[model samples]
Target: MIIGTAGHIDHGKTALVGALTGVDTDRLKEEKARGITIDLGFAYLPTPAGTLGFIDVPGHERLVHTMLAGASGIDFALLVVAADDGVMPQTREHFALLDLLGIRQGLVVLTKADLADEGRRAEVEGQIEALLAGTALEGAAVVPVSVVTGEGIEDLRSRLIAAAQGFSARASEGGFRLAVDRSFTLSGAGTVVTGTVLSGRVRVGDTLKVSPSGLSARVRSIHAQNRKAEEARAGDRCALNLAGEGVTHDAITRGDMVLDPALHAPSERIDASLRVLPGEPKPLGAWFPVRLHHASVEVGARLVPLAGDGVAPGGEGPVQLVLERPIAAASGDRYVIRDTSSQRTVGGGRFLDLRAPARKRRTPERLAQLDALMETDPAASVARLLAIDPWHVDLSAFARDHALGEGAAGRLAAELGLVTFSTPGARIGLSPARWELIRAAILAELTRFHDANPDLPGMGAERLRLALAPRLARPVFTEAVKRLAGEGRLALEGAWVRLAGHEVRLTRQDELLWEMIEPRLGGVERFRPPRVRDLAGLTGVAEPEIRRLMKLLGRMGRVDEVAQDHFFRRATVAQMVAMVRQLAEAAPDRQFAAARFRDRIEQDDHSVGRKVAIQILEFFDRHGVTLRRGDLRRINPHRLDLFGAIGEDAVNSGARSSQAETVSPDEGASRQVL
Candidate 1:
């Protein structure tokens, strides 16, 4: 077990720790000279509970960030509140940090009882109670001790032992990660990195990477409580002698993590809860400079509470901090947000969201959600987190938000059933209850489109994307559509999408309109047909509805679109194809003029000339029946044989026409000066 001490400066935190461990914690030369600890000092206690490692952090105002980094991996905190001073600024801040870190079991040490009179001690006790009233320390035992005179020192030792024994064992069976807080080179050894092992186990020969820098190192040796061990497990304070190409004291800095390669990714974005320092200009909502500390890296940030207008100083608000630089910290990682200007410690909290999109300002509803998660259940919080976006979530992003270790995130994902993994890195979507609601919304819109325009193909994929959830853009939307299609509720056609079994059905009036417009082109040889809009104007049908009916006919292959707004009934085009093929076979050498072709077909109907011309040209083009050279449509024997004589028919028809003599579809003809 690893135990750490926390409280205000001069609260006897180091003294009380010394009494329990028999090792002085003032390790720095500057600290011993100045009568204050400027850095962390380590000690080992041989207790019946286990070989407990102790981390004594400097409790001074200026070193609180250092205090946080030292305290992150501890199993329980020994929170020392002086009997004379009661609750100081650092005392409350440290309490907030520990609680934010999710440290559940700890003992409160009310030290220096020898200096304080009975009344003073009693008053201090009451104040400490008030300070810790709603925090995790409310019901914890407050042990009174005098480290100076050794009075109650034995009692403090026993209390620490009890706390250690009662603490839960760290999980040791997953991927390994160790946060390096100190790196140095021993005379004989090349380099050493020390931190409490947070999860899994690290053996002497294991290969690991130092994060943020991504330096690879091979473990040369392992030390637990100053004795060599074959392997180190979770909750052990370990010293790893790392040797290899990238191992260097300067390369591995404090606050840098050493972790498994496959599990976590390094990120610069953070979502967190921030409490304002009383000394700041505004509580929150107003931008205040922050000395943000996490994973042993201290960075400058702008903290603004996103959940509410302002968090009164010493009050927490659901906030998103814009980091000046990236740090390697996962969701659920506890952090300290202090005022950089004053150097006075502000309150700290656990990270509620890590991959939050940028926010211009705060909102009350969002804040309430964060508050509920911070004070409530983590599992339920994750479920709510999945709802923040409309698209399939990044699983790695979710893992970082919850500060889950190793396979812990996979376990949580399996429990929620929001998605499934096809391979190690690939994610496939599923219809969780929440996603089901989104799918239903999309399907409803599709039904509306199909109902209104029965003749047109149901809403195509491009239009459907525009109507999808605003957050589901491009790639994410693509995946959502595919997933919904896989579920069998939505049908996917070439470019068209619809509900299964949605058929294009036309009304009787539209069908009668089509019949009236169908047979107008019997005799003429050229191919200009009436525009659908003009035809609809004559039939007294709405133009758009008529166009929809035409498009439906086109989809079913019952009509052909000759131009933008023109259609030819299938019967006209098919008959024109047969007539052209027969003429090409009958007159292989003849050239025909387009005007003469009109006279040959010679029906009295004035519309026949233009309509048959439209049909003849469309049929030739569709079957590769004609070749145009200069302004003339030529009939070639090769095209006649390949595409079946449509060009020959145009040449034969053009032979008798009075205007420019264009070849019939069946006859091979070239323009000749006449």
Candidate 2:
């Protein structure tokens, strides 16, 4: 167990540690000369339970930031109070910081008991009791000891060992994260960094990334609890010997973190639950500036209250933190906020969401989301978030933000029985009930659309996506549609989505008109079909009626609109594709010129116009059936069946017309022309 010392300057915190472990934590020259702790110091003690690590922090008011760095990951606190100086300002401040950090397992030590009588000791005890009245350390034992006389020293040691025995080991289930506090070069060891392991485990030869900077390093060795070991886990004071490119003493500093690469995402905005200290002189303003410290990293931030204009003194509420620069953090991490002047502690809180948005932050919906994120349990938070309006969560991002190890998210998803859809970039999870609701909504929308527009084949995918409620991402929506089609519930034809049983049919009046137009466009001269004006004049139908019926036929996969006004039978288009394929095969380089294609079509019908042949090749180019470069064109082998099944019999006898009706005009056209 790691124990951190907290009290005012000259409160004998260091002296008590030295008495307990026989090591002087005041190693700095200035500290030795002045007889006071200046910076952080370290010592270790071994008992029957295990090793007890001591972090002796400076108690001067100006060095609270340094104190905070040392106290960030301690498993216990040792509150020191000099009997001669009852209670001081730094004592209360340090005590408040300990409470804010959620360090509950500790006892109070009243040093210099020999300097005062029993009445004086009793008065100091009263002050200590008042301080601990409503805090986590409220009924903790207060032991009075004199380091000079060594009175009650052994009793204090016994209590510390008992506390260590009762301490619960932190679970090592997350990714490894070590907040680097000290980095220096050792003679035999190239570079060594010492800090507390926040979570997970790190073994020798394991590669870790220095977060925010993204520098990679490999661990050469480990020293846990001041003893050489092959590996170190969470809740241990560890020293790592690292060696890699750019892994130098000066490259890494006190605030940086060496952690798993998956936890390298840094963010500048954070949403959190904040509380203003009751001792503050005034209420916290809506836009307050403070120095935010978390896990040894300190950065300037702007505090914006989410719900109101300001948070009154001692009031607790949700707030957003906008940092001056990005920092690597995880959910449920506790943080302390000091005033901009760095004099007094304003408040502290726990981080909820790291990727907070700058806009719409005060909206009720966003506030509700923040409330759900305040849950300490990650699974509970995910469930609450999924229960909200969107009813879907990005499980991959959630796992990354929480620093969960591999397969953690998959296990949680299975435990929750979420209906999941995966894309290349994200895995989205939705409740099974919500998935059924979405499926029903999609089918209902399709049925309503079919009732409204029976002539059209189906709705475009993008249009249907926009028309749906609780809009999903494009990749996720595409995956859902593909899943539905795979289950035989929906039909995904080209870019259109429709019910499996939905089919477009022509009306009686339109069927009669199409009968006349089809014969005109599909006879001996099908390659050079008549335009809408010519077809209208021949069949005595209005030009607009001919155009409308032709468009409907195009949707039904009966014809292809080769040009603005020209239309041809789907079988004729398929035969033209076959002719192009044959011409390309006959060429030396598998490429044919437009003039050659025109000549080839003219061989079929002597009256096929040059303009009509050029138009057909351009249409093929637009539909990815042919790749054009300047004057040469080549048949796209992959798109051979874009129009229909291609064969000599089908081309010569026009036998694929009925089969071609299943291929939509917009199908298989995603590739660009070469």
Candidate 3:
């Protein structure tokens, strides 16, 4: 367990730590010259319980930022106050900052007891009690000690061990995210970084991502408390030697974190639940700049209150933090917000969302979601998440990014009966109520599509997805489709999806037109067929409607579209394929003349013209019917079976061909055949 020091500057905080552990914390040259703690120092004390690490923090008013970095990862605190001086300016500020940070364990130590009289020590004790009355340290033990006299030194040690008894190591199950407090190069070690392991575990030879810079490196070695270690778990102060192809010491810095690569999105706006300190002089207005500190990093940010126009002192509400620069943070990170001038701490918050919308952020729907977020339970979170997002949420990211454990998330999902759609590495979930709504919406859209264009096979998949939920992720949509198809509720075509049991059925006028158009494709005009414009003119139907019906027919395999504006019945294309193969030998490089085959088909079918003959030759070219070589076409021996076999006796010639004619229904020619 790591115990941090907090107090005013030169208040014997370093001297008190030295008395207990016999280690000089003030090691820096400037710190010794000034006779003050300029930066954070470390000391380790061994007890039967374990080796307790002490983080002696600087207490100067100007070095509060440095103090915060040390205070972020401590299990308990040692708040020092000189007996003669009582509570000073920085003593109050450091206490407030620790209270804002939610440090629940600590003992108030009144140092310099040898210098102060008994009455002075008693007076200082009263001041400490009043200062901690309502904070996390309320009713905390206060012990007076003198480093010069060694008075109460053993008693302080006993209190520390007692506090250590209650300290439990942080769980080592989440992603390993360590905020780097120091980054430097060693003689042989390429780059080394040291910080307390906030969560998860790290070991030698582990690959970690440094963010929000997006550089990755392999852990060459690890050290815990100056001792070489193969692995270090959460709550252990660690130092890592990193090496990789492009990793350099310059790429890393204090406040940057090395974390699991999965969590790397840098955020500039955060939606958080904030509580303003009650001691503020006035209410905090919206868009007020505050010094944001979390995980050893500090930034300038403007708070836009979402609950009201402004937040009264001591009032807790949801707010949006628009940061001046991006920070790699996630939901549930605890942070302290100090005033921009660094006079004092203003408030502290728990992040609810890393990516918050900049507009309409105070809507009732959004506020309700924040309420659910403050609950800090998985089931409530899932329900609110499903309610707000039309598409499902990526539950893995939802839980991890929200600081919810994977096991708890799984239990809540099972309890809530969430419908899950999954692909490799991702599982997206929706509430049962939301999923039913989605199913209803999809079926309704498909019904509308079938009603409007009954002649079409089905709606395209991409179109159906966009119509249902335009913002839905592609993987989630694909999983939903597969789920529906597996349940036999939907059928998937090549590129179209439709309700099961859906079949193409044309309108009455379309049926009459089909009769007029079908005969044209079956006889001498089979190779050329009839164009859509001619069919519309022949039947007096609109050209657009005719084209729709023709496409519908093509989908149903009633017509083979042979080149542009060319159509043939399935049987006609089949017959022509046979004649071509019959004219060529079964050799691999067999060639046939396009003109000769065109003449033979024209003679056999009694058809005429370039449109019909050329289209037929081109039709054979496509479908591997034959490979075109200028005037000649070669038979693809592999596809000879597609030609089918025909008896020579059945290949009879037609005397006259059908005429391509057009008529108007108003002219009493509704039944005109082309």
Candidate 4:
């Protein structure tokens, strides 16, 4: 268990740690000369229960950021107050910081007891009690100790041992993360970093990433709990020797996290629940500048109140933190905010959303989302979020932001019995009931569409998706449509989605009009069908009516608009592919010029024009049915059935002729000319 010391400067915090462990925690030369703790120091004591790690923090007001870094991952707190000074200014500030950090298990120590009489000791103890009133450490034991006299030191050690044994270990099931507090190069080791493991475990040879910098490194060795070990888990203070490219002692510093690479995303905007300290002179303004501290890192940030013009002193509300630079942070991580000048702590809170939007932030929907994210249990937060209007959630992003282990989201989804829709980029989850509602809504929309436009094949996929309520992401909606099609509940053809039984049938009068138009686009002239205007003139039908029917036919897959104002019969397009295959086989190297194709059409007794032949080749190129290089074109065998299946007899005949020609000794001479 890790225990951090908190008190005012020169309050004997470092001396108490030394007397208990028999090791001085103030290792810095400046701290020793000044007789004050200037930076964070560490000491460890072994007991029957386990090793108790002590993080002795600086008590000076200016170094509160350093103190917070040490206190972030501690299992217990040790509040020290000098009997002579009683509860001083730094003592109150540190106590408030501990309370804001939610450190509940701790005991207050009244030092300098040898100098203070009984009355002075009692008075200081009363001051300490008043400071703890209504806080997390209220009712905590208070011990008076003098390192010089060796009084109450043994009693403090016994109480610490009991607390260590009673302390519960943090769960190591999440992804591994350690906020690096110290990094430097050792004599023999390349680079060494030390910190308390925040979650999961790490072993020798494990590859870990330094987040925000995106540098990866391999762990060469580990010293867990101040002793050499093969592995270190959550709640253990460990030092790691890391080796990799660009991984120097300077590159990875305090505030940078060594974590699993999967959790490498960094964000600059964060939405959180913040509480303004009651001691503040006035209300927190709508836009307040502060220094934000999380884990071991500090950065500048602007706090924007989400609900109102400002938050009153001692009031709590939702707010957004717009950072000056990005930081690697996760949801549920605690953070403290101090004024930009670092003179006083302003407020502190836990992050709710890391990827908060910059616009419409105060909307009711967004506020509701922030409320749901406040749930401590990850699964409970997800459940509440899924219950919102969209009725679906991005499971992958949620897992990443929460630093969940691999496949943890999938397991949680299974536990919730949610219907999951997976795309290449993301996985979306919604309740099974919600899934059924979407399916029913899709079916109802298709039914209404078929009734209104009986001649159309179906609704466009995008249009259908837009028509549904509780709009879903495009990829997720596409996946849902695919699943419905797989279950035979709907028919998905190319870009259209429809009911399984829906079929387009032209009306009797339309059928009569199509009969008059079909003859002109078929037979010898099929290679070059007339335009809508010419067809309208020949059939004596209005141009608009003919154009509308042609468009409807395009949707029904009966005709393709080979080019602007030029529609070709689907069957004719298939036959044209067969003709192109035969010509390609006859031509040298299986590549024929457009002039040759037009000549072949003329041979079939159709006066096909040069412009029509070029349009047909361009359409084939667009659809992957033909490949063009310069003036020559070759058939793409894989796309032969792009329009519809080519006749087997025509393909076989072309294949036999090509085989005979290849076997001929004069084949090379014949291939020289087209």
lDDT scores in order: 0.67, 0.85, 0.77, 0.85
Q: In model 4, which runs have C-alpha deviations exceeding 4 angstroms? A: 507-549, 562-564, 569-674
Q: Model 2: residues >4 Å from true position, as ranges?
A: 473-476, 507-546, 556-563, 566-674
Q: How much is the lDDT of residue 277 in candidate 4?
A: 94
Residue 646 miss distance in model 3 (angstroms): 35
Q: Compared with the true structure, what per-residue lDDT tens digits does model 2 show for residues 1-674?
A: 99999999999999999999999999999999999888889999999989999999999999999999999989999999999999899999999999888888899999999998999999999999999999999989999999999998999999999988998988788989998889999999899999999988999999998877888999999999999999999999999999999999999888888898888888899999998899988877777999999988899999999988888888999999999988888878889999998999999999988889899998987988998988888788888998885677887788878887666666557656666765566777777777777778788888999899887777877888888888766765766666666666777654467888999988899988887878888778899888999998999989999999998898866788999989989889988998999999999999999989889888889888788889999999998999999999998886776666363233223222211111122433221110
After superposition on all C-alphas, the RMSD of every candidate to the true structure, in Å, is 17.5, 9.0, 14.6, 12.0
- Cα lDDT, model 3, residue 272: 93
Indicate the worst ten consecutive residues by lDDT in candidate 2: 655-664
Tens-place lDDT per residue, model 4, 317-375, is 99999999988888988899999888898889899999999999999999999999999
Q: Considering only N, C-alpha and C atoms within 3 Å, which residue pairs clash in candidate 3?
A: none
* Two-way lDDT contest, 1 vs 2, winner: 2
- Scored by TM-score, the top model is 4
List, residue by residue over 29-99, the lDDT tens digit for candidate 3.
99999899988788888897777888899988889999998898888888899988889999988888787
Could you tell me how far off, in angstroms, the CA of residue 420 lies in candidate 4 after the best superposition?
1.2
Error of 2 at 254 (Å): 1.6
